[model samples]
Target: MHASSRHGTVAAAAPARGGRGGRDRRPKRADAPDWAKPPARGKQRDFKNEQRAAGGAEKTRQDTPRATTSRSERGVRASEVLRAVAPRTSAKAFEDVSRGTTVLFDDPREVTLEEQLHYEREGHVCIRRAVEGVEMIPMVKAVTGEIIARRLEAYRHRVSVLCPDARTTELKDVEECKRALKKHSQEDVGFLQTFNLHRNESSPAREYIMSKQFAKIAAELMGCERARIYQSCVFVKEPGMAETNWHSDLNMVPLDTNDFVTLWIPLRSLDEDDAALHFANRSHRDFALPYWRTIEGMSDLEGRYEIDTYDELDLGDLTAHHGWALHWSPPQPKDSVPRYALSVCYFADGARRLETEELRRTPHAEDEWSYETWLRDLQPGAVAKHFELPIVWP
Candidate 1:
């Protein structure tokens, strides 16, 4: 229930309620008083009030807006993309992601040496149309059903002074939620985030997050023989959500490894105004203990680094960045759709826990949570090989 930009409806506006159609079909002339006349040109009409004065109540469609998306339709959509959890027709596609040891590169998604080198030097790279149409359908359905459908009650757990709407009464849909939201807040008002979704029981996300194509790319980019997924997170920014502060993935992770990379997959296409993820080129080289931390405060550093972004990402397109690469997203434009994305963090299969002292050296807000969630089972010097952090590649 994090702040999430989502799909449509809720306003009494015509478009949302199927304008005109939601009203009585009887002739309007009959409802109008014989003495009443249309408002003069260049002015407006208060038809409802006039009707009331005329002793005619405008009849509206009785069904509430929430029922617009019929239960039958919702049922159909949920089942449609689930016929095959993994889109691949190959028998090899059926393994559980957690222990799926072999990365099947034979499916033709391997990265070229040149592409791998680009990542090595720039700390980030975009793979155009890395996923296909069928591949994205399930990804979207899984996220929308899990996040957006939960609505506003879940997003306001942390109130933001900037987003008064975050405290509004529970809303019916994405559009209504967006309208209620006042503005973006650096505190992440409109952005809904959930981590380890792949691990959720009866999850609809494992197929995409654990896709071997993604793992093979991670392995190639990290120059490792195998890769393990540390976590899979879904981030959705509702329209009107604010800019994210500059930060690095590794800065919040408790693992000790420079071999990490995160694959950011957009469920739909994106434009810059859609809250595109931006990165500081070559910034991974500057990352270490407290590298960007202890600064006066979080601020944009385009002047200090060569900031770059894809500006647009088609539905199948996704980007991967080094764990330590600095990145951020802009405030999403109000009228735009929610920006939905899935991010899977991977590392060499043998990644170990950060030294106890080093872990203590940095007071990352997530350290305690991370330890409680994934690292409590292993000692500091031990290779991270718990049930949750599975080896996703051979």
Candidate 2:
């Protein structure tokens, strides 16, 4: 889902291949699948034209009186609005958190029925002050320093830029690379991405990800007896970093269950304009919606869903979302400070591997890494219980 060009341009979907009425059979791009490759420059222009035409139709629909008045005419409550948009079982899980039914992770084992319902219904929940902002400062600084060092090394060596799992463009020289990095930092082209910090037991990020405090909450939210660490990454969104398109983590994962969760921990306070993550409330239940297999597809889905975002997210406040939830973030304001966030993904203890061709052909670099590093050796249909997937919850 993070597929993009070396310059960080979002890849557009290729036209359906084969013949009209036949199955799509677009040719795959070299080194990646069709879904991962940026559209040909010529195709991009055509796509934009198509989008503009469709936008006119969409505006007309929104202007219709029926569309503007439907929800208001029914006097729908906040909870009812969610129910109307979500599946029956999912809608029923919403609880009145303001009525003191919200459960903060004071005791992870003490997850209330209301808390569990909230997670099930909304596909996410926020824990205010889950960790002190001061506690994350050192970790953020350490990761940022590492990214710069790595970039410098790649530039000096005249080698390809190294991302978490793939090589990007080759740098001309130190100065050129610096200029490029600076330009990209301002254009939302690239961000500092480092993955699996928990591999180093001494890493501050590892300490946070493996901490019982976080794992217990993840386990409780997942409604699992225990949880395993699936992956961990530090995403440093430099001011003006590009928007992350809408997509579900589940589609990228090779697991066959909905018992996965991601903890998004911001290293600093963020106002709405600073590029906070947003969700399509209860959209996790809309599994039938096509997986955002391409950037174009994700953009299309964005036009179809109502996005929910927090206007002001404070430091230490953490968001936990189900793996299947649809979420995205806009580019940070150019004048804002850089955004550093740590994310840890967890899966229920008993999840099993999904043996499907689609999983095998997932075009994203991260998905490829997940398959090769975490699941390649496991037999299809077997429990996803590799040692790499360490159990963090009891």
Candidate 3:
């Protein structure tokens, strides 16, 4: 018999004599602690002393001057994380910007005649809040009629629907929209990005923007020595357009003075539920500081009483593109409802250069605009096949 058979026989017989069977006996372990009679398979932990020593070493390193770096160096190191996440803009161009001077206008030959007229007029200042609860000026009103007419024509062609109201095309996707963006790097770069749609310039709607009539009108309303398209973008909110996180436009356009204005024309008159725009008043003047405790939960004027309520605003927070400006609605909604709005930014002809170096040095640099794209896409001669409004500045 094999040794196993002999052992098994002995164990079976021993169990009959007493409980001294080999299978019933427990083995003694020398590798176990007093409290733990049975040793576990893994090695014991050395956590106590090692952790304390490591923590002490880290603290010592932080305290020692030899291991310390200057705040500027520390800041650069911290920003490395964001630099990785953000789309790369030309960092080299901005590096020596202190010594760098921007040509006030890139080229004079490209400046349109309408821009010249507006440039002269912007110097002659006029400020008025006209109409019932709406700011209006006679100078701006005359040009608005033409703008309304052009907008109406554009809407009919694009949507294949008619809006027979006093309001016309608030949103326009003109032919030269892409080319215009190439000129002014002010609008979308770095953290700011935009999308556009194609529209034929041969349409009557396209003819109006190219006629210099719109530029003349914009100059009068904006009260700028010249008014030019800083950026042109089209945004559509379908039945389920994603809501935008609360942010500011000023963050996109680095400016010295708050003399800039944006005209938001909606293609359709929008209702409350169909995603209207929300804005804060005069918040642009002092945006270096916080405006609201939180953007959400703010509904009525009383809710924003902590902040000055002198500046009335539309929509509290239901829509995206919430900013310091007073918000308004777009024309149409998806369920045969229209909610279209055109946002055009115009800056004064002459404004002081704001020193952006200090602002860029701030801890939160994520929201800054990038000039890299502007340098790449901007081309003077590249005219859009359809240009409703020329972007040239005198």
Pick the TM-score winner: 1
What would the per-residue lDDT of candidate 3 be over residues 275-374, giving only the tens digit for each residue?
4443333334434443222223322322221111111112110111212343322222224322333344555544332232423222222222222233
Model 3 misplaced stretches (Cα beyond 4 Å): 1-217, 286-288, 291-302, 305-338, 351-356, 360-371, 375-394
lDDT by residue for model 1 (367-389), tens: 23234555445555667776677
Give Cα-based local distance difference scores for all models. 0.57, 0.54, 0.29
Q: Choose 1 or 3, whichever is better by lDDT.
A: 1
- What number of backbone clashes does candidate 2 have, counting pairs of residues 3 or more apart or in separate chains? 2
lDDT of 3: 0.29
Please give the ranking of all candidate structures by lDDT, highest first, separated by commas. Answer: 1, 2, 3
TM-score of each: 0.65, 0.63, 0.36
- The worst-scoring run of ten residues by lDDT in candidate 2 lies at 15-24
RMSD of each: 18.5, 17.8, 31.1
After superposing candidate 2, which stretches have Cα over 4 Å from the reference?
1-115, 133-190, 292-299, 358-361
129-159: candidate 2 lDDT, tens digit per residue: 5655444455555655554555555342222
lDDT of 2 at 270: 53
**C-alpha lDDT (0 to 100) for residue 85 of candidate 1:** 24
Better of 2 and 3 by TM-score: 2
Q: Which residue pairs show backbone clashes in model 2?
A: 188-241, 188-242
